[model samples]
Target: MLYVFLSICCSVIVSVLLKLAKRYQIDVFQAITWNYSMAILLTWFFFKPTIPSLQNAPIHIYLGLGVLLPLLFMVMATSVRVAGIVRTDVAQRLSLFIPLLASFLIFGDSLNKLKVIGLIIGFAAILCSIPWQKKTANRKVYSNAWIFLLIVFFGIGIIDILFKQVALFKEVPYTTSLFLIYILAFVIALIVLIFRVATKKTKFSWPHIMFGWILGVANFGNILFYLKAHTSLSKSPSTVFSAMNIGVIALGTLVGLVVFNERLSILNKVGVALAVIAIVVITIS
Candidate 1:
């Protein structure tokens, strides 16, 4: 439980940092590049992963995670920029519902009445939380917001499911998996960076680089604790995922109100209430 709570807190801090990045004039791409680089270094220093023999592990695991990691970071950063932190977090976290449904259908995971109810309520809560306003002007800004949220949903949902699959390798130390995953992600990002440089579009900024490091550290901490908690708890990973999400939403909302001075419309208020109810149903289920 302590690990779970700490992980959620780390998530909130990540959101807060991203929100602050706008004010600090941090470029999203550069920030993420540096973030991953720093995370790789930090993980190396602390975890000291033992190299896994390729002969033993499935080759696809490495290949798939290599592709997924960079895309996940890019989409998540874009989602934060398009939607506010609160909405981005909600969209990404709510994706667990998709995986829960998938698990039941594909893996024959059982869903009791309470679990089903909780899933339904949680889904409804996410829908309610989406701010749908009739456009008063010609601005199409919010259009991208919806698309970004969808991307976040799909990316995070797939990632969560993938993590569960990876977790099945009980012999693979968590630290080793973490190191290999991030190392692959960094190498991929570096390759892309080289391409960007070759195209003469590589402009580096210190702010982006520094913030990226901060983001990397925070993200590493978040995943480390969450993974540990998932390992320790008897609850299903999906359930733990859902509970941690509720914590992020609650914390994000409080920070949004206090720090960003973001106000909720009546609809938003109702949406929040529904979200809370959904969380309750999911929790006690």
Candidate 2:
């Protein structure tokens, strides 16, 4: 329970840090790069995943997640800045729609009444979460913001799907696989950072350093405690997953509303509220 609580707190805090990073004009990519680097270090230190045991591990998935994670993270940063944390987080949480649909269509899993209702309301939540205010980001830009959110939604869903697949392979320890994935992410991010530096697209900034450290610690804490939550509630994976998603949505909405002063239409709040209910319905179903 404590692990779940910590995971939720750290998850929201990462978004809060990203919001603060924008306010401080910190480079998102740099911060994200450092984030993966430190997260890898922490994963390795605590898990101490053995390398030789990875001889038969799925290299493709590691590479795929490595490259995709950083790219999706970049999308998330843009979404957070333009769409506000509340809507961005909602989009992310709503991404469960993809996998839920996959369960019925691809995996032939039964969808119960609760899941059916959850699906209908989830659609409404996605629409309502989009920003309509012109000055918030302009209609045109908000339209593009939807693009970012969609990419984030689909990308994260894909990542989740891959992890679900990885669960079938009992050969490699998941912790080791996770560590390698972050290593790949770190490498890809470093290459991008080097290229951006060469083109003068971003410069070395001290705030990036400070913010990156903070983001790293928070990001790693989120993942660490999330895994812990599953261990602590090994019999109830659904509870862990549902609680984490709902906790992030609820807490993120509060942060955006109270701390960041994010303006949302009445419809937007309703969508967020519906999203919370939808997630619970789907998770339990």
Candidate 3:
């Protein structure tokens, strides 16, 4: 239970850190690169993972996650740019429903009535979080942002499914798999950086580099504790997922209101309220 709560706190910090990075004028790519680099180092120190035998391991499983990792970062960064922080985060998190549904259909995972209700309420909250354009005079800008949001939803939804698939692989130790995934992801990002260099588009700033590393370490900690909690608890993954998701949003909202003096419009406030209600229902059920 403590691990679960800590995961939520870590996640909230990630969002806040991203916002801070932006305030410091950190380029998104640089921020992410530094973040992942730091995360890789932190994960190494904390897990002290040994390389598992490649023999008898399904190579394709690792390969798939390796590919997914960099793509997830790209899409998530773009999503944050296209959508505001809060809305983008909400969409990305709630998009886990895609994988949840896939687990039911493909894996034949059971979903009880309570889980169903939770799913409904969770999605309802997501819908409410969507930023509605109110007679905006600029049609082109609105259209572009809306299209980006859709792309974000699709990208994040696919990423969630990929994570679930990786989690379901019982043959490999989850920790080992995660370690390898990060290492491979770092290599991929390096390759991408080379391309950026060739194109003369890469920009380096100390703030971005430093903050990225901090963000990465925090992210690694967040996932480590989350996986540990899941291993320790007997609760359903869906329930755990709901708790983490709602908790991050609730925490993010509070931080935005208190630290940033950001005000939620009526619709967003309602959405947050609905999300809280859904969390309660999911936890009790």
Which candidate tops TM-score? 3
Ranking by lDDT: 2, 1, 3
Sort all candidates by TM-score, best to worst: 3, 1, 2
Clashing pairs in 2: none
Report the candidate with higher TM-score, 2 versus 3. 3
Who is ahead in TM-score, 1 or 3? Answer: 3
Would you list the clashing residue pairs of candidate 3? 34-212, 35-212
Position 264, candidate 2: lDDT: 76
Which regions of candidate 3 deviate over 4 angstroms? 76-94, 133-139, 142-151, 229-235
Q: What is the C-alpha lDDT of each candidate?
A: 0.72, 0.73, 0.69
Give per-residue CA lDDT, model 1, range 1-285, as digits (tens): 678778888888888987788787777666766777887788889978888776776457756776787877777777766666557766776687776766666545566788678667666655655555533244334666888898888878777666666655676787787777777887888787668768987776676788899899898888788778667753456566666766676666767878899876676566567657766775666
- Cα lDDT tens digits for candidate 3, 45-162: 8777777787866567667767766766776666555555545655676666665666566655567888689768877776665555433343233335656566666766665555
Model 2: lDDT of residue 185: 88
